[model samples]
Target chain A: MRFRIRFAQQVVGFFILAALATLVVVLILMGLNQRWFDRGYSFYSRFQSADGLTPGMPIHLRGFEIGKVTSVDLNSNNRVNVVLQIYSEYYDKIKPNSVLELEQGTFGIGGGLNLLPGKNLLPPMEPDSFLPSTDTLLGKNLLAQGLVDQPANNDQMSAILAEVQTTLSGVNLLLNNVNSAIDGTSNNQLTGLLQGVNATLRSLDSVLTESAHGLVPNLSAITANLAKLSAQLQDPKGLIPKLLDPKGSLATILNDNNQLYNEVQSILDQVNQTLVQVRGLTQYLNQSTPQITGVIEDTRTTLKKADDVMTGLANNPLLKGGIPEKKPQNATFHDLRDEDF
Target chain B: MTERKPNLFERVGATTFDLFHNTFYAFGFFWNVLGETFRFRSRSRVSTQVLVMQILFTGVNALFIITLIAVSLGTVIIFYGNQITTLVSTNFVYTILITVITRELGPLLTAFIVMARSGVAIATEISSMVVTHEIEAYLAVGINPISYLVVPRFLGVTLSMVALNLYFNLSGLAASYLVAQFFHPIPANEYFGQLMTQLTPTAVASSVVKSLAFGFVISMVSTLNGFRAQQSTTEIPIIVIRAVGQGFALLIVVNILITLVFPR
Candidate 1:
């Protein structure tokens, strides 16, 4: 039993060692996969902002990750100075004029630095040399299009906070005003005016109701009668059309030349006879002119006496207490009574 | 004679003292085992036999359950991992698997299995030996029980944990691929290539380091609990329960500390 246990132990120990060996091999494989053995050359880039840039973030050429970010530092100028380590194999792809673009993933999921090559065919950039950044273009474009937020420095953030505080104060004031209005503590003139207008509107409503009840049907009936009359006038057998028709009586009278001449001659004869009678009557009036004037004078005298009698009757005490004692017409004179003195 | 009840302060002081005392004892035992592990030339035939026997008991015996749980865990991970393939790239999926299996679950689950199985067994065996006066017999024979028994078990449990964690990772990844074939059906080379690309040395090192630390903790805690047993046979079951519980707690705390210190 002891020997069997010993054999089993040896077998288990062998398996344990094997498992550990496999683990070490896996670690080595991972190191190799990460290019830990590869010789890389470092380059530097300066950006205005290192917003999404981080160490170990891959640097891509086209779509391939040819390098990685080694470090990011804020220089004394408040600019981001980034160090990039590119594999020696891809060193030829770097040019002195190559632009390093710090791009973020869509919806801000991931971000990376991309090397956009320039037109000049210069030799490979020296290790540790500085490369230009696309920060100016990218930052401005992203800020303008609202694709990315602006990096808020201490001063800008403070300014934004101040503005927010001011807005909050204004909102607080507005809320206070609204609360006062709701509680009826502030007697708003507009509210009183609105109430008055509401009362007027109620009166106007009653007036309009009366007018509608009284006038609407009558107006409708009048319009209906007008419409009937218009319909009758528009009928083919109407009087106006009948009168204007060539075969109608008025048209016949207009169309017959001899009859129209005879009618005009008879109308002229009647006017001449009437003028003769008017001349006779004028002669008669000239002969009786004196008598007519005397009769007009007599009639005026009789009218004056009748007016006096009517005035005396109106001034009788029984009628109006001596016509209420006519007001004096004199400028200064008045009868002085003992009580007035 | 009538026993007097301990006051609150006395009870607190006793608890505190026991905590510190047990912590120091476990640490001393760990140090001694570490020293023995390095003393290759001084190793005796009996110690070698004991070490081999421990390896057989802790590691070889636990493989079946470890493999079973690992494969099942892998299948479940891949089943859900494939669902997100449409939203994220397959490379990202591989990264998720590596982070979950290698970085977190692999070492932790292996430690749990070892603590549940071998940890309880070690405590019960040692406590029983103590109760039967076998420990006294070893001392009478001028044998250092710690170097003979505890050191071998320590080395055995720690080595077993590391090996089982490795096996678990391997079997999990393999099983995940098999399950993923039913959903995605990609070539094996392509799948493995993507996985390799996503795997990092830091991640692998973190996993191995975690496994090593957890193994050491589980073994030390279990052995320490075993030694706490008294002459009464009733203490054996209590010691075993304590060993399992304390070993689990120490494993989690140590795992968290290592992850924090070596974040991927």
Candidate 2:
């Protein structure tokens, strides 16, 4: 009985030990699975707003999850500060200029922080150092449109409202100016000036019509006369052709050794001298005409005025006393005596 | 006069009372066994002959059926897995296989097999012992029947379950690879490498934990139900049937609970 019991005890012990060993092995394997012994470096990122980001949300680099968010806190600057722990194996890949962006996935699923590595080959960032946070264009647009909450003062909407108010005021001022210009006194003056211009244009049109009517027949007569003269000149046996022909009488006379040509040249010179004298006389007449007319008109006016004065004296006898007598100059007599001496 | 019907409150009270009573009794039995097993100074109470007998009956005897079912299931999984591979990366196929087999199917199928094959045997054997007054004989001889009878079977079934589950996983994965070879024709080394790459320690640990828990429930429920048999010889078969049913139900519930707690 004792031997049998001992054997049973061994069997039970073996089974229990095997199970415990299996559990221990599983624990070790789990530790390996989690990379529990692997060295990890910590870093942080600062976001303006947390959005949907939470602790334990994975941080991915190039689509691979290298770490997880360890903590999310509000910093002094009122930004969300997220701390992360990445495995040391990927330390070299993280540059100092790396930016962490909170990317939202499609269909509202799988949103997380993605690290966008910088192009510069700077040294890896120190552990616990803060990485810069970038707001995606979607996030910025959403914030601008007031679809997302702003962590700080909402200045975008206020600025837009101020601009809109300024624009409205400007439009109001423009409308007022337009109204004043439309209703001011200058508008009536413009209408009157336009009417006067229209009347002047009508008179000018009548004058031009009368001038055109009177000039048309004369111009037609002149043209017909010119045409007749041109026809005569164009005739082969015309007098102008006969005179200008090289073998004609005028041509012979106008030749180099002809007496008649010299006489004709002397006559033409005399005629040119007469024309010069006439041109001078006409210029003198043109210069003196306006002055002569003015003098004559003045003398006539003075005579008429004297006649009027005499008539007035004749009509009223008291007016003669009011007229001043002509005074003789004493200096004239003395001067005449000295001259005579 | 018509029979008086029990009120809703009385019915509810009675049901609640029965539930608590059964729960507490099962918990008490489980606790006692745990305590007795831990009492290392009383190691003589467990018999080696009986432990070996139980392991042989439960573990060795159930191997052929477990292999048959596991291989067939593996073949079906691989046949469908070939279809899935076309849609996803081969790595994703490994992930799906590991998630299905290691996380859910392996421990469950092994538990069901042990329950159906050995659970009824343990319950009926214990019930027969009870009916023949063998337990009374043990008590008269100043031996605790629990230590002599229950402890060996408990250790045997639990340990055997864990071992059988490991075997099931190996055979299942191997047979699946064989079946997959006919369709996809992947090299064995590369296939295993891909599987190992996707396999995680947590998945294996969860599988182990699930099997451990399942084994505990099956052994405890079956042994408890067996010991519930009273003086009637006819009660043995009823107790055995109840043990099988309750063991299966408990294992499935435990599997679901474990899965919920440890999702991939």
Candidate 3:
């Protein structure tokens, strides 16, 4: 009988109403968050493989998620046909010549497919049409022709990388002088060569560590990474097994290998060729930005042993069976470098 | 008539028959309560007071404890969720929050609260009404005890369950966002933004459906046990205990069934 107060009823009403309000708010927020009411534009892109690509992976433009991978299908051509659902608002950015690049995460980590809009101010491509991938020839042509918007390479990041490149080149120059240093002393030249290689890795690692700011830090974390990578390389029990473990490069390499080994290898070869020819790898950088960073460090690490190969081959004579079994005949400089860097 | 005790086979058959008979009666009870609820405008006004009082006792009174539990649980999720953010995306952490707090735990935990407080109370109160002949008084006055006693409570508990579940979701998400600030300052838009995107209409409906089922099960079990009371005062605690236990068992079963039936 005491529970029959009008105020109690009012309190109940307020409680229920508040909850109803929250429910309404949640639904509204969900609608907005999911673009429930927005007009969606559909488009498809073909990739050589579906590695690192999944339905609902975001389609980013300048770091903002503008859409998602709506579906992944294997088409008649035996290629991965990824359908994209771009929001109507961002549809204007999907002009002609726009291409998609599946960005693999650093260290097999966080990445999404980026929408590099056409550099031309042409109209948006029709819905349900194909968008080429940068992995394809047409995509490379569009990129080389400056038709697709690559990352805005401002002078700041360029200048920072140039400083690192200069330091690394100095290390290379010092290594080039190793032939003369080898004429002087054996141990001193080897130690200096190793130091030069490490310093090169440290500088590159520092640049990527501050990738967001595009400013290179004082190279410090390189020693730890080098130590970790070297421990994987120098483990005594087995030659290849330890280097292929989860802690080593092979595990990370295999994670991208389901359908990605070819793409990654081609890109690495392209980067190596580009480095020698023009010092430019900005085009392939969009594919697996972080992966390139890891490979570069690994390449520099293996480059340290290149001098060892040079020294041994320079002095040793050819025999019927090449040479007697060395102490750690398990690994060679070419074998290690070919597998990792 | 036979005076000897029934054999084992006869006893087993009788118990099995009783089980089915009781199940049939329970369904009838549920349909009647649902019918009375739909016919609310035509019902007696006194039951409105009962409904209001039921909500006051069940929903309004339980707000503080609900907030305390919701906040702590939400904070714990965000704390642990961030630790694994590297393996999964930031958006993924928020999505897990929506799935765990809103979809799974919200309805179930709130129903447990209501059942503990109001379900036990409903059974005890109704058993006392039966013992004191108040139920018979209502029947003598041409009023149906099920309609007069159980229907209002059924509606009250059902409505309160829906409302309380919503409260749990809101307070839990809000508290997680606040607590998440301590680990790393997450932009409010990004935190809530990902949660909103991850939340689906299917999930929301699933949660609401679970709440309704739990409320229906708890209220019906409590009132059914109340009416099971015999002509002794000692039966009140027995019926009350039975009601709480049945409410718990039914809520869990209903939750499982709903989750399985509606794969969200």
Candidate 4:
């Protein structure tokens, strides 16, 4: 009985000790949980829309959580009022010019809210003071516009794609046409056209040949005629030179017959005078014939000698071989007194 | 007239040797209970229910306050961590929570809580059973003592620790955001978004695994010490002290192992 009583007392003591230990730990945890004796002040921020904010959300200055969101509620004027449970040590950090923003992020699941501790270090926000809210994305409607303009955007893209496809098809057709042209054949009726072209070229060649044959003779005749004309012009009697020369004797005789007749008369008069002189000479020789007979006999011997010399000279024709076959027998001599100086 | 039991040192040495010998046996017994819980080849609804109940008690019930505590902790930490780290990054409130909370505080705080809350309860329960010879009674009755008592507690705490860790992490993350809203009219929109993106599933999973292992260590050490207690009132305090000390040591070692397994 005594041992059992002692064991029972011990059990009770153990329970008490366990309870005390549990109490101490719980109290410590509770104290740690609440910043029971930490230094800090509080402040209020009024926002139009809290976005997706909740009570336990962190209150960040710049990007750091300076305090906790104690409560979020709608005020009398329908503005969102957030009560901050900030540490007193961080009170000096919140400037009076701080702005709160409900920024919507582009690449995140949900948009977030921000408290921008302002840059102005003029004065700190007083405890429990309400800061005016600014920097809301109130008028921006990109999210709504994205939905409204969806179809037009898609249509634009599709139109561009179709244009690209059409252009590509045109390019392909152009390439095919070029390939046919370069290879120089097509199923189209080009064979007949080629034959016609060949025939035309043959006709052109024949015409050129005929034209050349005809021109060759004409050119030769023209050249020969020109040569003949040149030879005729070289003659003094030719009509061309007579027509071109300046008033020669033929033109002078034709134009002035009286002067030409006077010139002929003067020539005939001189010839008549020469004839009379010759006759006079002959008569004088007859008158002196008898007296000259005796002198002739005496001179006969000298004449005979002269005749002999002439006969000898006439006999040696070889000595004068280059002389003309016949000399002029009509040679006339005039009186020396009658000869003019 | 009687053979005196060995001196205190001899007895202590003998008890230590017995503990070493019985440890593997205890493990084997726990393994069998696990087998029975799952009913590998033969299904047993009763054993499974008991195992489930143990899990619910140790894991679910114990972690009920985790969310509340974690959320509040996030708020307070952000409030303070923001003040210090604001100069570094305005959004660093989330980062601080992620780096400090997920990596260390979430697991460590849970472990410490469990050690004080559950560890003491286990040690006392087992010690009372020892003083009363209930364990001896089970041996005589041809029932494994470890399966009856130790396995349930071990499995319970292990499951609970993991569950509680997840609860704490999720709650801390959510609460940090909620708490931030009150301090500022508009909170940073990308704050929590960035937080979720930064936290990987693997990180959360590792914390769970760490907590599970911690549960096993605390439960096992406390139960083992209780089982080894002589039928003396003075032995209770000693066992309790050893339980807490060994629990902490095991937690540290396990944490190191986890660190080595999965680097920061």
* Candidate that scores best on DockQ: 3
Ranking by DockQ: 3, 1, 2, 4
Give one digit per residue, the lDDT tens place, for model 4 in B167-219. Answer: 67667766777777777534444664466544544565567678878887888
Ranking by lDDT: 3, 1, 2, 4
lDDT of 3 at B229: 88
Top candidate by TM-score: 3
Off by over 4 Å in 4: A1-341, B1-46, B185-189
Candidate scoring better on lDDT of 1 and 3: 3
**Residues A1-341, model 2: lDDT tens digits:** 55534464465456456646755754565565445687689998777788778886767776666777889999887878789888777878677556777856433344577776655667888888867666545434433454322233223345678899999999998777556555553455555666677899999999999999999999999999999999999999997889889999867766867677678889999999999999999999899999989999999999999999888886786775766777976663455446754
Chain A TM-scores, candidates in order:
0.39, 0.35, 0.43, 0.32
lDDT tens string, model 1, A1-341? 66546478568857778897887777677666668888699998888887898888888776677888999999999999999999888999886557777766544434578777654567988899877676766434534554332233333346679899999999998888667765657777645665677899999999999889999899999999999999989989987789889998887877886888998999999999999999999999999999999999999999999999978888776886555577768656555663364
Estimate how well candidate 3 is docked, as a DockQ score: 0.34
Residues B1-264, model 3: lDDT tens digits: 979999999999999999999999988887887787787767878888888888888888888788888999899998998877745555667767878888889889999999998899899999999999999999999988877788889988998999888888888999999998997788999878878877888889999998888888888999999999879999999999988988898888888888888765
Arrange candidates by TM-score, highest first: which order?
3, 1, 2, 4
> Over the stretch B1-264, how does candidate 1's per-residue lDDT look in tens digits?
899999999999999999898778767877877787787338788887777778787888888899998899888888887776544443556867888888899899989988898888888888888888898999999988888878888888878888888898899889999988887787887777667767877788888888888878877777777877888998888888878877888888888888898856
lDDT of 2 by residue, B1-264 (tens): 899999999999999999999999988998888887776345673475677778767776677787787788788888887776654434456766777777889899999999988888889888899889999999999988777888888888987888777767767878989988776888986777656645677688788898889888888988999889999989988898889888988898999998889856
What is model 4's DockQ versus the real complex?
0.01
Model 1: how far residue A103 lies from native, Å: 3.5
How far residue A89's Cα lies from its native spot in candidate 2, in Å, is: 2.5
